[model samples]
Target: MDDLVLLRREFDAEEGTFLGGLRPDLVWDKAAFSRLEQAMRRVCAAFAGRDELPRWLVEGFWFCADWVPSWTGHADFPRPEPLEYYEGAVERLRDLQSWFVTGESPYLEHHEWPAI
Candidate 1:
């Protein structure tokens, strides 16, 4: 399967925590995390220049950056940093990506565990 496809599936399956929700033993290493970040950047770049973004990008891809620090408490994996692009729509995407990678959501004052 394509890396992006697998990533999208993982992002969706894990509800934006990436591998953070998995067992500690199943957590990904630094290299895998880097690849995931690259994949996310590619997706962000693809839509960043567009005047209007699609619903999937806003509802799905953009939300993939919803990270939870507590989710990684049991794992020692390295976390991804936010991409450096801050132009136009990409800025929002990068902010969301930052939230996922760094547990700092620009839209919220605090990080809370999602209610189940």
Candidate 2:
């Protein structure tokens, strides 16, 4: 299967949406997160050489990658608040694309996670 197809399957659009700021229907477990991460990585690798990437792909990948760790940190299972927790993932993805194309990594702040 195509990497993009795999990623899209892993990140089901209907399930990804929040209902009244919560996603109770989705499985928020380690196995689910691991599968998402793997699918995202495969998509990233497949698109590394491309001049442009799909916006949904970048946004979905970053939404999970950036928020999952913080969501896991909460003792009482709190839903991830996008307004409060959103890191600039699109920009980071752009930097990653540049690095793949130019073989140069940009300087990152200590707390910033690399897009790849």
Candidate 3:
């Protein structure tokens, strides 16, 4: 499947509002957040084990992570807040994309690693 198509399937219009367009005051309801988190997890899983991801996928994940911190809470996993997971996902995707670009096994910088 195409990367953009996969991203679109994970993050649909009805799921959660786009982070790039989200306002600071906007509060997604429980269901909306559930949809968003589910999609994020699915996207993450889809990209797992890949040495490199497409540029579009990295951009999409970055866009979603941009607004994760604004959410109130989640219904599914909660180890890394929604925003945190998305942010890390973006870095992971970027590492993969970088691998494609530079032919390196380890692409992430020290700062790119998620803080524990």
Highest TM-score among the candidates is held by which one? 2
Lowest lDDT block of 10, candidate 3: 107-116
Candidate 3: misplaced stretches above 4 Å? 1-6, 9-21, 70-116
Please write out the lDDT profile of model 3 over residues 23-108, one tens digit for every residue: 34344344444444445444554666667777765665554554354342334423334666545544544444444344443533
lDDT of 1 by residue, 19-69 (tens): 544444544344444555556555554544455654544555444433333
For candidate 1, list the clashing residue pairs, or say none.
65-100
lDDT of 3 at 80: 37
Candidate 2, 1-116: lDDT as tens digits:
56566567554544542211224543344344434444554455556557676777666555554454455445666535453332343344344445434334455323445322
Candidate-wise lDDT, in order: 0.46, 0.47, 0.46
Candidate 1 lDDT at 10 equals: 56
Model 2 compared with the native: what TM-score?
0.48
Location of the lowest summed lDDT over 10 successive residues in candidate 1: 81-90
Off by over 4 Å in 1: 1-4, 14-28, 54-64, 73-116
Off by over 4 Å in 2: 13-22, 25-27, 78-116
Clash count for candidate 3 is 1
